[model samples]
Target chain A: MEILGYITLTIFVGAMVLMLFRKLNFPVQTVLVVVSLICLVLGAVFRFFSEGWVGVILLPNEMIGGIILHPITALLAGLFLAGALTASGGFDVLKVLINKLQKTPIGLAGTLVILIQLPVIASLPCGRIIAAALLPLLFAFGFEGGMGLLTRSQLIVLIGAFARNAFGSCGPSPIGGVGQIGEGFLGAFFPTASEGMLRAPQAFSLMLGTALTALFLKLITMKLYPEGVSLRDLPEGSVIEKKKAEAKGSFKGYLSLVIFVAALLISIFQPFGKMPVQTILVAGGILMLFMCRVSIRDLMSGIILLPVTAMASGFMAAGALASTGGFEALGNILKGFSSVPFLGVAGMLAIFVQIQTILPLACSRILTAALVPVLYFFGPAKFDLITWPQLAIVMAAYMINATTSCGPSPLGGGGMMAEGTMRADTGYIKGAFTFSSMAIMAPLAAIYMKFLTLSSFSASGVQLGRDVWLIIEFTLVIFVANAIIIKLSSKVLSEDVDKNWLSQLPAFVIPGAMGGAILAFCLYEMAFLRIIQGAIGGIIASLLIALMVPKRLTPAETGE
Target chain B: MDCGTTEWLTFLFLMAFYLSVEIYQVLRRKEGEIISFAGPDIPLGDLLGTRANVRMKDGEVVDAEMSGCTLCLGRFEVGDRVYVCKNRDKYVVSLPLFMKGRRKRSDFCKSSCRREQASIQGL
Candidate 1:
């Protein structure tokens, strides 16, 4: 049975790789469904004498239902809201705001800063929508020299940097799908910590990791594209035209945007009763549809626009993997390395990250849900060798990596959107983005976890030294190693450089200092209210910016 | 055998079969040629609306001006072939076309569509 588990696991992994590389052209839903049915039939056949075919069939059905209900349902609601907003031209408001930024006196670097910061600050649950809206503006910035003094390659780097930052930060949003999934898994596994207690710290840790990774990637982009490349560098007619129009959004569109913002704030702060994020989203979407005069039929059609079945099947596969003892078998194998602490933990995280990256079907949420339990069950609990904080570091690493690692694969989700919108080569983007993400994220995760642990210990009046020192040392070593790796890799993979190596000094120092300050605040004084306040403040600031833009440039006129 | 062991063995067999099917599909494909099935005539309304009733047949699709799949609602590019289901009055933009792949024919857009078709056929 154990050997059989291993074989099944190998085949599953192989199938995922084939799909990712486009060697398998079948729909992902088809592949997953087939795999799942086969597993069910085989299980039934094997257990016929004991449990009978009826039991086997019913079990798998129940498992599928369980997998689909909570996270997938929530995700569907989010997707529906995103669709409605897009249909109602809510995103056009942001596009107009971004366009107006081009006219601002902020230099190329400052414009680049706003571009990078916009998505991170907006932190909308639907990443693809955000990417779809912004990618063209980024391109326009590159081609029309919106990055004022910065060269073309710097623009690409900045885009990549923002992509990494925006996607990684999803795990922290209190009202986002990824955040709900991460929190669900965390609460399930660590019963002692209430969801509320874990929410703020998890959000802070994930956000800090993202900020640090963004800073590192920015520096690397500077080195890699010392001479910048621009849209003109590409063959003529290759650049995709901006999908949204240049006119200011309509009054209704602006109102819809405001409602969406208000909904997110109300969901997060819960000034009234505790409303589910999905409920808020659904209400906002309906209100937007009515206000924007979109037909109900169109809204329903928009809801089904996303590949919900494909994602649901992916979750089903995760459930199957768990039910079949694949996770337990892998966990048992990993247990041997736990005695060595760093090697075991790091190895497991690496495997999880690799699996999440290659397996288009294994979404981060389901993957985390399946694997974290296995870790808790098989970890070094007997000796009490690993502290909860250390385990948190591991969980944080997995959570951060699982969310961001999918950015490079052109399979589905953000990767497909990024490739389609940016017109960049998926293969090249995958390699550079994944490598840069791991280099920055892995160490930053350790540092953030260490800070979290120390803060907790200090609050409890407990002295901590050995574990903290070890983590700090590990972080420094990992940081240096990744820096060396990136520097060398850039040399071999460097693209065309057009501009003089203008100082990325201001760009680097300012963002770095700001990110450091934010991380410091999060570590010491962060609270749920503070996070909500920040979100509300960011929304108001964005709305104020939108109001300043001329109405003529909105997407309604431009046929977005 | 224990229930757990029985479950594991069943999963393994299923995975093996799935792997074999995938390998066979890969080996059987004709290299360097895009495979597209000729679909039946689907009205423009059916293609644009949420519900479609077009089916795939040997004949060329006529009077079915290309558009997004009724099921998935994704935009279709020029030269992209789609799956037309006649009995169910549904049309799905082929997965290959949707993902911009070079190979494979227009079938159900995804597994759910295939399953829906099967149920409609009382399979």
Candidate 2:
């Protein structure tokens, strides 16, 4: 079973890599299907050899069980509401309302920050819904979109940062978020885990990561690969007339917007008792159609099948792996590494947490679903590699890393929407996104959980006052180290293959190693050997990760 | 058939819904807004020298100017770029007349435009 699991994992990863490098030419959905089917056949073969006919018949039970329908249904419900909003001119009303926010005393940068983080703050079930709503608004700040509020460089940062926040917002969302998967697993031990065990750490890390991503976009992506950026700065002292002269919306538009807000409030507050969110959203969508004169076609067209289908396919592959004990095998293999002198348990955990971030897919849920179970197995209930409190810290790191991985994915990532609007070639902002996830967000999440979040649970031998300072100190160091590396790398780097690797890889690896070690220490370890092993483990993971970072810097390097 | 009732229902619902959308789209397909090309009937009424998002015959919307005001064949054509200012409730486009076939530009959009330089920034 272990060997079969190993084979399945290898084949799954190999197929994805083949697709990613363009060695295999197929759509992302097709690629995933191929990977899943391959894993299934492999699982059946292994089962047949091990336990004859009975095992083969039971193979699909575990495999099929991996497909969780809650999120898919939730996604469809969210899309339905989004479509109705679009059809009824609720979006237009929103545009006007958001447009008016420009006059607030908070000023441009402050207003921009609020708008960038709004998706996460709202805690929508799907980030795409809010992203679709407000991305046009973000673009309007650009020269191409005709508002001219920001320079081209500034526009790139704003859009990129907003995308970073938007794509990861679902991680902390109360409404059928990907983080709920981790929370569900954690509920086995922690009584209050399901109430949102992973939310604070993810939210905290994502907020800071979003800010760093903005800096990275401005300092690195735009300057490093100017050709990828299709936007131009305006001439000095030129006047750009506003694109929408009136910025007015109709009565129906306003009515739909009101209902939209009402829907959000109802879902969040659950005003009418604990009805399923899908029910609320679908009801809201139906009301929108009637009041706003929206056709069913308009509602249906708003649905994007790509991410949903990708996740389902990912589930298929994961199911095959799980049915064959692939995750168990994977855990044993990593545990086997504890015997290796250079990489101990801490180091192995570091690499494990950062792996999904390094090889990001279209949806965070894909890898998160596969790996969180294995990470849970590492706790005292299983291999005893880490305690429950320690597990919480690691889980926090893993959850944030998993959630934000989508920001850097080349395979139909949500960030691609921002890239399209910005007119940058694909993979333009990938470096900033991956580097921050690996170095800044992962360690930051771990430290935050260790100090504050896990305090409610009986995490022994920790002082509040000391831990608070340590959190601040660690965050500053990680933030400064990463920011310096990015800023310096940007100065020398170009978007081409050779130029991109020249400094970027080393920068990523060094910080990734540091981040891994930091996470190990945050697991409440003061030992020298564990820390060194953690750093070494981090280095190995970072190397694989650094190599995986996209090499396309220029428009000429657009296609795989 | 292999999955649960929810999955079956979801699958069926999506198929029917999308099929209907496709049918609706095909049924409702129509041409772009057909302005009268400013013929004698309309007489280019206050549309001259104004920067309007005019759809070309190819259906590409461009910041366009009316070719003639007086002699008035009265159709919109794409130009180097357009600058516009408010004219009562309308916006009149100010473009450098293409007297000698387009005043020289800087090769391509340097990612900057006159439209992005103004103070109004978001939304």
By summed lDDT, which 10 consecutive residues of candidate 1 chain A come out lowest?
A: A548-557
TM-score for chain A of every candidate model?
0.70, 0.87
Instruction: Give all TM-scores, in the order shown.
Output: 0.63, 0.75
Docking class of 1: incorrect
TM-score: model 1 vs. ground truth? 0.63
Which ranges of candidate 2 are over 4 A from the true structure? A236-239, A242-246, A269-277, A286-293, A412-424, A457-470, A487-500, A549-552, A555-560, B1-123
lDDT of 2 by residue, A1-560 (tens): 76787888787778766644435434445556667777878878877888899988887787888776666566556656766776777767867876677788877777888888887886766676666556557667766667767776777777778777877887887655777778777777898786677888888888999989888877776665554544557767778785752467899999888887788778667876765566667678778889888765445433333345545666676677778777777778889987788888888888988888766665677677667878888998788888888888999999888988865565431112222222122356667778778888889999999888787665465677887898789889989998888877877775465676667778878998898789888875798888888899889888877775544432232457
Please give the interface root mean square deviation for model 1, in Å: 17.6
lDDT of 2: 0.65
lDDT of 1: 0.44
In order, the Cα lDDT scores of the candidates are: 0.44, 0.65
**lDDT, candidate 1, A428-521, per-residue tens:** 2343444434444533553555554435533455445655675466556545555554454344433332221122222222222222222222
Please report the candidate that would top lDDT against the real structure: 2
